[model samples]
Target chain A: MPHDTAAHDTAARDTAARDTALPGAVAPGTAAGPAPVPAAADDGEQSLARLEAGLDALESAAVSDRRPWWRIVLSRLLPPAVALAAIVLVWDVLVWAHVRSGEIMLPGPGDVWNSLVAEWGPSRIGAAVWDSVYRAAIGFTASVLIGTVLGLLIARIAPLRAAVQPLLSGLQNLPSVAWVPIGIIWFGVSPATIYTVVLLGAVPSIAVGLIDGLDRVPPIYLRVGRNLGARGLDSVRFVLIPAALPGYVSGMKQGWAFAWRSLMAAELIAISPQLGPGVGQVMKFAQENLDLPLALGSIIIILIIGIGINQLFFAPLERRLLRTRGLSRS
Target chain B: MTLTIDEAAQARTLTETAVRLTGVTKRFGKQTGTPVLDGIDLAVAPGEFVCLLGASGCGKSTLLNLIAGLDPVSSGSIEVSGGRAALMFQESALFPWLTAAGNIELALRLRGVDKARRRTEAERLLRLVRLEGAAKKRAHELSGGMRQRVALARALAQQAAVLLMDEPFAALDAITRDVLHGELTALWQETGVTVLFVTHNVREAVRLGQRVVMLSSRPGRVAREWRVDIPQPRRIEDADVAELAREITDELHREITRHGRVGVDKGASGHAS
Candidate 1:
């Protein structure tokens, strides 16, 4: 294909020469002057090539090779595993030292594990996890859709951005859990209340993320895009959005976290027979029943799910995005 | 070949003026303030390599921006015989997300080149810039010189008759800049693209351009113009280039001194000593 294109370029040069009577018609590699120094030019070219090669060799970065899969997995998991073990050990020592009178107040890791095995077995926990995960997925998807539109509107429109940007930041700081009272009043313990709370929590961060990303797109990219004939929506599509991907991805990650937290809060407070069993609902029930082991176990499960989602989904995505742009070391 | 012939014909029919700026003025804010570019008139012929030389604050970059249509002139008209001019900045400005070829390909793709032909065209352009080996390399992975070469290739991929370069080699090291000067000359000769190169370096202007234009600072106006009769493949160290660079540098110093307010006598006498 390159050969074909090279031939085409040569042919074009020939035709350009024959067609144009101007001085520019002089063929490539042939000097424009009558008395041309071919030998000197050749030496110059050789040295130029040599100099360029040396500079490239000296300056061009060597992209480091990735670690082996097992090593990567071990490096990622080992620290957290050790941290969890240390945490459990601390909790056990506290329990042994009579930090609390009984299991109702503070259960040891063993009691929590035993309770988890007896009552919250795989099937029960799986059902609870799926219910919460499903709600979170739906709420987050809606938040993303709404937030993207809102973000684009805010980022592009000056008046809207000026009017709403400060408010959006304030909204991000407001706890999504605080919306539960109003949500219950408005929707009365329905799935809509849960989703509404999740959306309230996630949307602000996503929108703010996109706005920040758009804001940080280097001005040079826009000039280059304009120079390349990218105008209006084409500029945004080809240049602005892609340049802003890192920020947007980070924003979405934060949005997902917010959504997860909001879902848990909503489920914990809005517990009822109508709503199916979820991790948050289980925690609430365990709390009401004064089952410290189940409550602690549920908290651990929530933490695990959050970390798992971030590691398995968002981490890899952000890593790949950064890696491709040569922004990441690993 | 057909594209080149068509462009050449287009240039000829347009009366040999590849780029013309008449009474071009650009101001940043209020109309009361001194304009960055004040009633500047410049004409570049087809396939001419014209270097715009200036001191700092002379708006050398602003002039290129006006020609490239990145910014609107506050007043006056600028015309290009061909379509939009392709621009290269001092910074390579290559998209970090894209590889070297990908950057060129984006230019091609944005120019409405179909997907199937864009890759081949991009590769050919990289080859033209002698960067075939660095095609798959991302912008951050490549050296500064390599990135600039890719930028030049990407500019070429626009296939605009007029190429506006705003101090494109200003950031490169001495040796790399020298090598690129030769490369740019060769590419200009081969492609017959009209170049409006902006630079503050007198030697660079002399080394590359067929015509060197000097602009005075404090509301940049054309101070002087020199038609460089030096032949092609002129080095920065060439006697003719150095001689011309000396003359231009002296003129530039005088132009800069004109704006001096305090310690002018002391500075002049100190320099004389």
Candidate 2:
């Protein structure tokens, strides 16, 4: 786009040209004086254009050019980039040094790649991914629901808080994986055990997070809410919850971490063919077969899936909440 | 929010009282610590502006809190003809989560206004505070004066007959404070709701109050009374307001310098139980 001064300069040049040409009408052949005047007119117009451009430039922040579309795709692929490269290099180095074993023992990256492709078209690998996704989702949802209610209770009720504050903190310190044996005994290798594991993992983090969030809310907001006629649950819903969003989001992030880790641990310990071939079972199978590349590949896939879920859902949710609340830079 | 002014007036005339306090004493627990507000008797006639002035820790805020139904009065009865009193704090105390418009809307929501009327009512209150253009701005984005104005609008939206303010302009700069004082008095006169304002600034009391009640500290009690006969638009430096302020301030000094005097005054007023 041309600068705003360009038009202004043209108008100035027109006026200058008119001033010089008015006397030139008397003698057209004697064009030397007119020639000098036109050049001067051009100079004046150019200066005017420069001045106008400067003003426009000063008035606005420069608009930035968009990055290439390739960058968007590259960002999505970048997390797995180093792992992919390193694995390839390791496989090549092992084979070149004659350290690679047979297909079932210390399998090469190419062996795992072939296994993934062979399993892909049959829909089995897709089913496995979806199975894990669905189970984890159910567990996560249940934990969020139960954890939020318990957290709110602990935050609001004096007696409950007194009874539960220390217990909650203590429970949080105990790893959810430690409860796997009990969860298995209680609910067997079914989704029930999976959910129990997930809840145990996530609930404490969420509740603790919510408490932290609630604590940070200013006392003045409570006073204001009351003065505005916010009584009982209305105050909590409208005032307390929104005011503590940052804490809530952080709590959610922590809860997701617990849930993901717990699900992986649960599946690893309580694997059954009846329970479906999820990522944890795949990891176990690869390890038992002594296929190092396949084991590493399964591990890599799980990490990628976890990160993808976060980036696709929770991260965006958090970013938007922060942006709307002006907690994030615009 | 259901405390209707029309009903309050009809009830007051029928019942013959707007607010009545008898033997109200607020005692904080400790061996060395004294009662924040020892004993007090105060009565507010309808459409009156009473300024409560004292030093810090004189229980000015405690008094406001009690009247606003935020806390129970210890050892005394505070009766309001209005069901509940609306309160404004020194800090704007607006919810940062809500925009200026949204803050006003919360009050309206509590008042049982439906979704449709909330926007219009919020806009009306915003204009009343001379802030029609700032409705969409978040609470933190507003200037201190603007935030207080939004807070005032929210309080007004509560639709209570009594508006209790605890140093609502204390955090504001002088020019904004002066402007707000004028705006407040004008609004008070127009609304005709009883006002009980608490402040540590003596001249603010004289400038804004029709009757300034001087409070003693370390066991707050009514130390003295000054009837401010100054007309509207009075400045703090006005000879009349300053002269009255000096007189009251000297009494405040006496109250602070000495100990146990506040209790004696309370007992004499028959406000000590």
**Interface root mean square deviation of every model, in Å?**
9.8, 22.0
A1-330, model 1: which lDDT tens digit per residue?
233344346446544643573332222332212333246544444455555656666665465566889998899889989998898899999989888654446788999989888875666767899999999999999999999999999998999999999999999999998998998899898998899999999999999999899999999999999999999999988899999999999999999999999899889999888888899988987988988889999999899899899999899999989988888875
Q: Where's the lowest-lDDT run of ten residues in candidate 2 chain A?
A: A26-35
What is the fnat of model 2 with respect to the true interface contacts? 0.28
Score chain A of each prediction against the true chain A by TM-score and list the results: 0.82, 0.69
The models' CA-based lDDT, in order, is 0.85, 0.76
Tell me, by TM-score, which candidate is best: 1
Clash pairs for candidate 1: A12-B1
Writing each residue's lDDT as its tens digit, candidate 2 over B1-273 gives 456987887775635555677778876554345677877898887767899998887889998888888887768888876678899988888877778899899899988999999999888777566566567877655667778888999999988888899999999878668767766865675566789999988889998888888787767887888777776546677998889888888888877756555445654535545
Pairs in clash, predicted candidate 2: none
Point to the candidate with the largest DockQ: 1
